[model samples]
Target: MRIRTRLLLLSLAVLLPAIVAAALGIGFVYAEERGINQRNLQETSRAMALAVDRELGTREILLKALASAPSLARGDLATFHEHARVIAEEREASILLSDENGRVLLNSRLPVGTALPALLPTAVQERRDAGPDVTIVSNLYRLPRNPDVPPSFALQVPVPHTARPHLYLAMTTPASQLQALFEQQRLPSDWHATIVDRQGVVVARSSDPAKFVGTHVRPELQDSMAAGEGMHPGMTLAGVASTAFFSRVPRSNWSFLVSVPDAELRRTGLWASALLGGMSLLLLALATLAALAVARRTAQPMEDLRHDAQQLGDGAPVQARSSGLLEVDAVNEALVGASERLRRASADLEHRVAEAVASFEQSQRALLQAQKLEALGRLTGGIAHDFNNVLQTLTTGLHAARLGSDDKVRRLLATCERAVTRGSELARQLMVFGRVQEVRVETFDLAQRLREVQPLLTGALPTDITFTQDVTPGLWPVTADPLQLELALLNLVMNARDAMPHGGRLRLRAGNSVGQSPAQDLPPGDYVAISLQDEGEGMNEEVLARALDPFFTTKSVGRGSGLGLPQAYGFARQSGGALVLRSQVGEGTTVTLVLPRAQVAPQEPAPAAPSGGLRGAGCVLLVEDDPLVRDTVRSGLEVSGFEVQTANDADEALRMLAGGHCVDVVLTDVVMPGSMNGVDLARLLAREHPRLRVVIATGYSDRSIDMPGVRTLAKPYALHQAVAALNEAMAG
Candidate 1:
């Protein structure tokens, strides 16, 4: 409709065809280059094939001439041997003469009386089967007397006598001769030459002859060779997948293969095309840019309006400007009005975005808190696993010391035993905090379990503090992991003791509660409330509000891990219960655990086995990656009258077993070095030696527990526990 618009459209219409023509020209040039390269490769392959054919033909002629020597026709054997030796020395090949029955009369490589190998007779028979005067080129083989030499082929010809050919003459040439033929050709370094006999075994390769010669050609090449000489893409004998041009050797079943890697073949054509295409593209871009510039200059009125409209769309202030044309002036005025309205709308949107951002930040803070707790739980689990193994060694060693001790020594060992027991309890508490320990819930009397834990509680309290317990008679039984509940109670007691550095009263009380109003956010149900109250320095409202947060401790750094209260809270919530705390500074702190009461009565505890008389038998194979843990456990097992052998990891353990070491039980750590870890080792042993028993000992709970059908001994186990586990495995 407009002159400027029509000019812009006309320029693009002319430029588009030019760009297409340039692309077509580039593609044609590339195709022509590829065709030339393919022909060159075929010619090179044919020349290499001709070279190999000439080498074989020359060897055949030399063998025929040796058969016609004058000394051999007479009865003078020494003269014939001397003539053969001279011919063999000149050709640098092994020459042999065999009787019609295939016994060697003379061999250039070996002594005069040495017997010829079966290969010579086979070649003679093949020649006879093919009719008269046909030369046979045998497959590659090693010389009979000199096996150390490279692989060689036999060129066999029957000596023509008045009698029916009593003697057969053969010339042996090593594949190195063929290698020389390939080397003489002037070809590209990237091209590889391979010559294969009719059997598809490589007689020579130009690239790394020692590595590829005597190997069979790749199956793809074998298939292609059957159809005669041609160019095909296949894997080479060097194991590189490539394109090959092959030619059949003249007058022979052998083949000559020339290979060029696909990348190398395409490199030259692509480089030439890339140079030409880049120049063409640069010129085309320049032409298009020039055309657009001229068109924009001719259409100044429309260009000014378009620029103002773009500024309005991007929410930037648009100046009140217009082209002198009547239609563009009217459009500019409308855009100015639209721009004002958009500015107001954008302001309103900004106000709402501020409020949304504030809400999002609050949600992010809460999410970050949960993630922090989860990360701490993982850290605690890993630490507890390693700590448990250390304590296991300490526990076992202390028990061994206590066994043969004097009265004074016995008292010291007792103290050491108490400390080891405390260390093990600490590791278990860390596992609970980490949420790594699997919970086993059973109906249990709450009061009785707390009473059993009281002695440990009292031992942890200060001498000036007084401890008291009051449980309502016939308290309601709660269904939970008793061990976890006991640990939670101990945590609360320890907090109360720390509150009262000076003398104070610590009381444990349990009662039945039936309403939801008492504890905020607790479900309405019948519950047993176990409370620990201390008359000690306590928390204010501010400190108490953030008390349950993980790593939020008022105590000085290094004095507290800040995980105690959160651990108790996690345990209570996971057991379908709630933890509540109420306190005021300088008055006291009272922490209560409110658990839903079980509907049924509690089950009685199982009778304990007599651990004192427990002894392990049968030879035990101990596998632990840690040297200290392994050595300590081995000493303990020996003291317990069990035979023990040790390995650092599963691989060494397997080596020992394979070396014929006898063992009835395999005690292996779950994680070890090598491709096979303890779990993998157990599975292999299960199939290979069904009679052998496996005891998987692990300090880590996560991966170890997931393995099915294997007995796991959690570390640091006392020596007796390990022995008990082994005995159980042996018994099963």
Candidate 2:
């Protein structure tokens, strides 16, 4: 998943439970608070009911005592009235009495016979309303002359004296005392106790009496008064919701109502829940944010790793970043290390690949050389088969003409012979091209040889150009194929000449090279470096690198043969040397031929010899594959006064040898068209003709041959060359 999505999921995973728990926890706290509020309200209601019951019990006892007193019926002015007055004073009440006509006869605080209109009317009304012998309680009314005082209750006791249900007397307990009882009642903060008459009128309230007392008691209060028991119920006064409980005083027919606002009971719980929930939400939100931050920090390392991996995959270098968290830091460190290793490994791989390509190219070059050599061998064999016959004919014809010679005809024959010689030279050049030439290794001073060729090089160049030879003195001699080395130098010098067509200076130089350094791939050793340089129009780097590639020529048309540099390169490698090239498009080029230096013996002065060279004293065996060639050679020997025995092939020569022909030399064709060539024939006669000197002559060469103690002569040779070769063979 993507980073944003993953972070979101992680945040949710961590935060989900917190939010849920906070909500549930808040709910639980609210419920607990609500329960506590309810319990407190219930306790306050009971407290309020007890307080009301005590106050009502005192009022009812005061009312009963007044009703039984005989003076309480008469008046406060009579003996009974004085007694009643004393009783009222003791009870802290107001009292009055009435006659049979329902006129007030005595007033507890009045003079001897006072008619109080409110009191007399209240008494008469209670007398008229009373049944026989029944005590009745009256509603509160204002006394006639005492309107300032609140209406007091009429308690009528009908005596068996007069017709109007006897005289009725009534008394009132102090309303202030009744109200003080309710007001002092203990209740919860939101609860209040109130007293109500049996008619459901509000009388005394624990709250503000002026406002609440005149207000009708709640329906639950009325029910409590009617049932004479307590009841708890909910009420709405105006819009405020409250819980009301009521209980009545049993004897007094008064009610106690405790009203607790539901809002009050729930306020603490609601506020607590609000405060807790708000805090929890804030805390949870912060926690969620923190969790997201932590997750992102942890994931940072992975993100960097992924990005770096992508870069590497796209072939860029790997990169890493740092994070502060420990695990993230460790992961980042690992990734950083991995990236570095990958970079190193990748660089190593690229280098190895380059080396592998170079190795493959070398193998391909070797394979191509092998294939070319095989093909050349076949071609050479075919050509030699044809040319041998032609040579035999020309050689024989020349012999016959010289025997019957006119000087001009002989000269003409010499010209023909020259043509044959030139053709033979061409054939040899081709053989060398096929790498089929026999090589003889001998120690020679390469530097001296180069010095000798310097003057010749100067003569060959134009006058405007100068040849400078920096031949290091005392340079070591080297063993090499001298002829091929000379050819390679010629090709390089000619290439240099073409580069500097404007006649620039050329340098032929040799020195030791520190190879396999960054500057060169040659090892540190003694080297014979023959450098040919010119202020020439040089090649670019692309061309320089591919300069030795076969058939790659920048020269136009026949102006150059591409084989020059390639041949030089091949020859150098075959001779255990290296050819390094350098050039820039504007600057000149340097072709350095590096060969391992060799040691040589110091030269000794020689004296002149006798006119004729030494000759062994034995008959010479001539093994010639061609009859005409063999006869011609035999005649030359006879003329030279040397004894000779001849055969057309190795087998015949062997038979003649077995027949005891005494030979000082075995002269034979090296590439005879027979079961055995001259080299094999020489081997056969080697022991028998131990004193024999073997000389080989051929028009072709097989590069595979490694015969020793042999001197090779080209076909169509003059008499002098044959004599010279024979002497050299004997000398060796």
- Writing each residue's lDDT as its tens digit, candidate 1 over 336-367 gives 89999999999999999999968855655555
lDDT of 1 at 179: 75
Best prediction by lDDT: 1
Which pairs clash (backbone N, Cα, C closer than 3 Å) in model 2? 75-81, 76-81, 118-143, 118-144, 515-522, 516-521, 516-522
lDDT against true structure, model 2: 0.64
Local error of candidate 2 at 566, Å?
Answer: 76
Per-residue CA lDDT of model 2 for 1-732, tens digit only, reads 766567777777777887788788888988999777666655655565566556555544565565566543443336766667787788677666655466666677776756565445645555555554555555444556656776455455544344553555556665546666654543454566666766777666666766655566656546555765544556634435676655555445565666778677678888988998889878877877787687777676667767766776666665555656676567656656776778778888999999987875565555555544543443455456436534654654454444433653454355446446545654654554455677756667777667644533443455566777887767767778766776677667767877887888888878765434212555666666777877789998788878998766677543454667998888778767788788887678888887776656534325323111212334667888655466666655554446878888888877877787776677788756457877787676565566667887776645444567667767656555666677677667
lDDT of 1 at 162: 29
Candidates' TM-scores?
0.45, 0.35
> In model 2, what is the error at residue 189, expressed in angstroms?
6.1
